[model samples]
Target: MIVHKKPEPTKVPGFWEIPSISFPIHIAKNFAKHVNILPDVEYWSPFLNSKTCNYLRDIFLESMILAPVSINGLMDQSYGIGSKRATGWSLQLSDMLSEFIIPHLNEKFCSAKTSTDWWQENPKKNQAWLPVQVSPLFRFMKYESGGEHYAHYDAGFMYEDGIHRTLKSFVIYLTTNQSGATRFIRNHLEDIDVWDRDHSDWNRRALKEEVLYSFLPQEGSILIFDHRICHDVDVYLGEENLPRIIIRGDIIYQAKSL
Candidate 1:
């Protein structure tokens, strides 16, 4: 005897399954051109629309829990001086962001001499290096009035495969501020004195003349730079009621195999 079988249920995608937003071609070209000229830094204004920025800000403020800054598993105040919250691992968010930016980054870097010479280190003779993804977790940071981050370098995180690591760091500004600009130092890594628990004299070491670049926060804008760059945040001097809000993430790259 033959038995009738029921058809399987169709699966529905989650809320975060919305289509990835594509950056404008002209904006992408501009970003590439500026980065190519600057070599290690680029600030893309209005990368995300005001509505999207508002949505992210609302969600983060409502759902995420902020805590004192933690450094290397400890709540340290010497290095970073602000509150931070992590969105945890979200593959959807990571893929969305990566899809929006990776294509442009890959196209620009893979074809440009600036990337081969300055961005990447010891790349394989002829192998191709590509940006794979943005980090799965996004760190939301809040710097209240009088808060500041000392001079420091962002350390890259290695992927499970060991061949890839976070090559670039990015920050998305959610709120506009008159102060609290991100300052990049011109000194070499060896010459810069990074802030530590015992040594908190980064202010004295980071001279005004050594500042290579300073970017003020703009709502819906993003700043991207090499992970090796020495940078710090100037003291937050904005309104006491409005703190500086930013989302931080990294771009992982598949380096040419050694």
Candidate 2:
């Protein structure tokens, strides 16, 4: 007698709730757009103006022409990177960050005071209060036709100077595209039992089986989420040569113990 096997469980509708907020003001004009994001994800709309976006996109395109594109993700090239023929290029924007991004982040965004004032005004007698930090690491990502990413979490921030660094992942769309939205899982994949297997294998399976919350990639718009969240870029559904381009960075938080 043959025994009937139990069918695999299907993902439930609205199993994970994705919440978003609008930052029409307060954040810079470039990061002032209506955001579609996962719950707890921080959004700074209008992260870049049209002019800046165009300038950055041109830089990425020129780099692709000058340098050979490298495969992204794990060295194994699995989890949709190799299969979809996706490629990436990286740029170190420390100079840009110091000249432009850092000033804005400290003055207008995270903390509105200069380092001297921030330290002097703090309650700590030793002036040891930790301050906000931004990672110099940045990447310019590109995905052509059928290019995509499987579900995965970003790298965590490294500890620095006896301070625990908690990272917030940032991505800004630089290309005009309506189809290549980023998909984020509602909950952390590490907490789920289904993803207990090998990283590559489980990530690909989670892409198909997990509940996904998606955000449309708007030009100049930025999405920042806690690094532990699982996310991936959806397959490009538009024209072949028209690639989806984005700039990625990380924000590290340093907080004093209460």
Candidate 3:
């Protein structure tokens, strides 16, 4: 007898789900003082091209220097230096990014609520606080040998019926080195023998159906896509042996209440 399994849904990018991982490359370059290029296409193009929007260099540098704080060090990155302490610069940058990107990202992405929604979440109950704002201060996660990330999906919305989802989650790779690469390590098919497809779970099973896209986000380059897709960073042991670093930030859009 033979059996069949359902085909997986195509992991397409969702524009309405999560925050679109894009930078205001165009607005920053042109600096259309008061013109509000917020809705212009010419606005986003220049941001991706280096020579055009180079002012952002200072921002990335500032973020990189400060990301050590929010970074969980060993826990989040799975490996790091002496101690696991968040620095002042880290906190400041997180706050600054949250404030600066609010209006801009809100304008670009299709989120349900704005900054105000953050205050309503009632932190005392959740314990988990969302970034009211985030900036490009995130850096590369370094790990020594035997470093690995357990799997978990970014939380999605759920109704009484257990129906929920987020629009998208975009990751901006400031740079990549060492052993970092988006990898999908699941059995393509079910088993028949030792040579058959013996499915193995690498990082646990928080993320079932997902796609990991390895991106090379230049100084201003960004990787924009869906958030519901389960993802994780691979601990790298690069031959160069340099500390892997990348600066990134995050934001979330909620559904408007009825």
**Which candidate leads the pack in lDDT?**
1
- lDDT assessment of candidate 1: 0.61
Superposed by TM-score, candidate 3 places the C-alpha of residue 248 at a distance from the truth, in angstroms, of: 5.4
Clash counts for all predictions: 0, 7, 16
Q: What's model 2's lDDT at 232?
A: 72
Candidates sorted by TM-score, best first: 1, 2, 3
Q: TM-scores of all models? A: 0.71, 0.61, 0.38
Q: Who is ahead in lDDT, 1 or 3?
A: 1
Q: Rate the local accuracy (lDDT) of all candidates.
A: 0.61, 0.50, 0.32
Output the lDDT of residue 242, model 1. 93
1-258: candidate 1 lDDT, tens digit per residue: 111121221321111222233332122223322454356677777677676677667766765466666322125756554455543345556766776778767522433322222233433532455677877656777777776676766766664454566767999888999888888876544433322212222544367888787888888778988765667887778674798989888887765544
**What TM-score does model 3 achieve against the real structure?**
0.38
RMSD over all Cα atoms, model 3: 15.6
Show the lowest summed lDDT stretch of 10 residues, model 1. 9-18
lDDT of 3: 0.32
Q: Write the per-residue lDDT of candidate 2 for residues 149-222, one digit (tens) a residue.
A: 65666655444243434346778787778777777754433443322422332244234455566777777777
